[model samples]
Target chain A: MNIDAFAFDFQELNKEIKSSGQEELNIDNCMGQRYIGCGLSRGSLRIRGVPGNALGAYLNGADITVHGNAQDSVGDTMNEGKISIHGSCGDTPGYAMRGGKIFIRGNAGYRAGIHMKSYRDKCPVMVIGGSAGSFLGEYQAGGRIIVLGLGSDQPCPVGYFCGTGMHGGKIFLRCGQLPASLPDQVNAKLADDVDLQEIEEDIRQFCAEFDLDRETILDHPFHVLTPNTKNPYRQLYVHC
Target chain B: MQIDYFYPEYEVVRNKEKCTRCGLCVSQCSNHVHSYSEEHRRMITDDAKCVNCHRCVCVCPVGALKITGSNHQFKHNANWSRRTIMEIYSQAETGGVLLSSMGNPKDMPVYWDKILINASQVTNPSIDPLREPMETKVFLGSKPASIERDENGRIRNNLPPHIALDVPILFSAMSYGSISLNAHASLVHAAVDLGTCYNSGEGGLHDDFYRYSANTIIQVASGRFGVHKEYLEAGAAIEIKMGQGAKPGIGGHLPGNKIVGEISKTRMIPEGSDAISPAPHHDIYSIEDLRQLVYSLKEATGYKKPIIVKVAAVHNIASIASGIARSGADIIALDGFRGGTGAAPTRIRDNVGIPIELALASVDERLRQEGIRGNVSLIAGGSIRNSADVVKALALGADAVYIATGALVALGCHLCRGCHSGTCNWGIATQDPALVSRLDPEEGRRRLVNLVSAWTHEIKEMMGGMGINSIEALTGNRLMLRGVGLNAKELEVLGIMHAGE
Candidate 1:
């Protein structure tokens, strides 16, 4: 199915896309058409131009490949499936996403993977090839976030206040030095051989998807951050 | 163990002749004022532990208890009375916390009471609610961008996804940890029986109430406790709790002491860990960020459920509601300052936000001005007291109203303003298993259903008297309301006219 989104409103275009009965969708001239392919399952969407916020949001078992940069809140609160972004993405990339894998080939804005959680068998994964802005993985309860600085030259690829209130989950950053003022609630250390082995598959996949050398990426020192305790705020508010 | 102290204000006295020595008061008192002595074989009172709630006086079988002011009297003056002097002295002793409950008990102007409803006299004939088919059923959701027709000129997709209600009233959000399981069960049962909805209040959905998912609105606050796939998919709608009216700018903190067993399991946290919902959703910094969350929930729910944005009524609410309207939300729930909470700082609860009435008026006007009134349905809450307030709220342009205190009142909450203590005498807001079991879901649900049904009938009657057979016509029809004693500013804020010319 081939549709020009500039001609119709998002609702009309979405209705045509849903009713077209085609497994493959090629949306051309897509400009700020929000909620495109939203909750779409069992289809392959290849977006041509820049898609709006929440593209492929709550995408359940579908494959979405965006040709260009994506807007804010991409794959927000998503449950499953894969969204491969060819260019850079916006803020809160995977906000509260419980499951599925979001791979960005370029830089991501602030609060990437904020409030991302994991359940019994569902662990949401977000991998950014470039640096992330401030407040990375803020309030991250569970899941895995990997930031592999491929082309960036800065000594520290990630921004300030990384893992500020993080109580769960593990963040792997391939950087020379960790942030100077990491919050007291988080523990940061050099990724050991076992830690590198755990994320080797994800890193290999990211390298394979974006066409990067895996050895060059793995050669740099990586820092791993995890929450200090299971219950970080147990003694803060009330007299228990 | 006798300790001498100065009695500043009041004392509790017991009439020995009327006292039956049943020892019920001894166990009921939380402050340990009354006790049973084995040697004396009778009950004894320790006067220092009394706060003068009059509970013993009211509960005494023979009216044996009375409270009196101790040696604290004012000189005979025309301007001041003894009670006034005692009140000041009591405040001085207690260091001026000024705890209260229900609504504002101060002598300020209650605009809802001052505003009068108008009925049809001659031009338009009034209809009887009992006889005529008056429409009380309301659906809260986005109206639609535009009701367009196909090439055949037939109606196409007239309804947006909405939660249909038999009555306009719904049970507001009171989490399981804040209240008890029995109280939550009673509310769920009442919502089912009355064909309305009850909010899960960010505590996460209890496993036992999965059968009542259609009548539930699962909440996602900053804490995101117990928010799993099943919880998200169970509810008819998802509400993002941005701010609560009782304590705006403050997050919810169900203390570690209260998080026990099922409450802890449901929230998916440790047994004694504080379930802290941050003041703001750390992710959302702007309206665009808010849109991301709204759509995320929509995506997670497969776009089958409508999303509701619940925000406290604050200053600049009109503009804030405009942003919410454009945030892809189907419903906007505005809570006023007088809303109830289990626990809040005393200062924030009393003097923080504006009234729901004024907020509703301004939001309605702003949405209509933006020509996006049909895009999002408005549900006003915080302090919707009775059927009359419901009618006036509809006239002020609310699609529906949410009620918490009123429903609790039906379940025997005495409005004693003691929810913070976590030992609700009525068994409505406690975690203790023994206390929770006192409120039977069956009877409590029946009482709530009765209260809402009675209010619905009254709403229908009021609409019928106005010659408005449908709730849609009654909405935003400010001509049907007139202010009786409100000043010009109050009238202007409420968007209604002063009484007669």
Candidate 2:
């Protein structure tokens, strides 16, 4: 449906869009109204202004694009969908997501992708163009998290203890140097051709959306982090 | 030679005449006070073994057992008395951690006891419970915002989903793992019979008890264990357990050892792995976040179920209740400090949170002031002891009362405060196969039903005496209650008047 700039409750507008028999929905003056295109299975939501927290929470199979920065907890606990943010997003961009793709063009706040999990044939992916905050992917159970440091001078775009309590999943960082004080549970190493192959599709999709060269992004040294299986910590207490 | 130390309170006495050769108590005692001698003709009783629960005394079939208070000389001073000495000794033994159960066992004034119930005297006539139709039935759910009518002026879907209780009492959340399967079955069956609801605690619903969904309030805590499509659909309502009163600000930990076969399966955790429910739902950072979860569950359940947010009665409970009322929750369950637990850090259980009476009154008053009392129904629980406490809770503005410890007491809980050990002699709190088998569901359920029915009769009697015929009339009727020894702050928080003038 073709629409013009109007101050509408994003929730109501999104509801209208889902119920309407239209392929494209253009929401204008959408100032901080939440759950836009949330749980929508088949549709395209195009927004002009800033969206609120949980922009596409539990999104099943729709596609959402935000013209401006999105709030915290974007695509939170979602099962499937694709969210492309033209501007930077806030913290916990893909929290507890089981399946989906979240592509952000700017920096993410603390603990992004925290508790993100995955299952067989459904590994969620998150790509950030700028730096991420401390404790990134804290307690991440599963899923792939990639941070591409494009125009930043920081040695590492991610912060200290990047993958604390990370039991499963892989984290790819497009930086030469790894953080010094990584947790003992996680093993960090230079990404080889095999590591690059896993996140190749996600990087290509991110490059295609934001007009970045995938080969140049892959040329930089990458660090892949996975949980160390040998040094497993167990039995922290006595029963009696 | 080392002398085995007893509590200095109990004296173990045995009858020499009816002494049996069987030394079952000797092997049963965990204190190691009993020993068998091949040469001895009869079993010997050592005085240093008992914690005064009288388990051995009650077990002996031939009536050969007796226990009494030892005549250990403490200078007769009321201030420095036996209880004081015991407290000190307990602290010394457990290194200053005082663990207790079944409400505050200390000398602190019990407000429920001090508060007196008023009845109609000469001016207003009293109705006898036997003759009059005194309404003890309570329905817990969201009442309609306003009645709606059809074209013919007939009622059209005016009623909200509610649990109709024969009395304003319910079995509170004591999980299957914390107690036993038989105990859970007993509670479920009793709740069905008694026309009340039984909470499924944080433990997931047992497969066998799926038929009792109408009487079950399934819980979802931080762990979200066994919480899926079926678990949500298999309940009358969903309770989001935010904080437990017994151990406020602390999460639940069903130790790996207790997680056996079915318990492990229901909790959806590996056997021998501690089911650690973190103190908070990581996603629930604010009231708005709580609303998301509440609505999500409602959506998942097709909005057929009312959502209950159970929170611990902390110091600032009134303010918190205000926020919860606006969080789209249909019911607010307030658990006080005196509530029971399978296991909690001793410090948190006894030393934290406020009394339920004050919390209930404050929350009701706060919601009323905010003009949102109609938004949510309040169910108060912590240590609702008897019919008197139930009536008092209603008068204090609770729509209903949740009873866990009281129900367990009916089903053979001794309140030994040793639930952490999981060797519950009464078979009410243990997960051991043998101990759990001891409690037959048939008999246990009957006991619970009897307890609730008896309490219902007492509640009706109390209501009839006050000339209040209905539970709805009794709710927030503070005039029916008067404080005897409560201070100004207590009386203010309780929203009741002092005894005289």
Strongest candidate by DockQ: 1
* lDDT (Cα, tens digit) per residue for candidate 1, span A89-207: 98888876777888999999998988777655777889999989988888777789999877888777788888877867889998978876788888999999989997898888877
- Chain B, TM-score, each prediction? 0.90, 0.91
With candidate 2 superimposed using the best TM-score fit, by how many Å does residue A170's alpha carbon deviate from the native? 7.7
Evaluated on CA atoms against the true complex, candidate 1 attains a DockQ of 0.18
In model 1 chain B, where is the ten-residue run with the lowest total lDDT? B1-10
Residue-wise lDDT of candidate 2 within B1-24, one digit each (tens)? 323243446677778788674676
lDDT of 2 at B240: 94
Kindly provide the TM-score of model 2 when superposed on the true structure, using C-alpha atoms.
Answer: 0.79
TM-scores of the models, in the order given? 0.82, 0.79
DockQ of 2: 0.13
Candidate 2 pairs with clashing backbones: none
> What is the fraction of true interface contacts found in candidate 1?
0.16
Highest lDDT: which candidate?
1
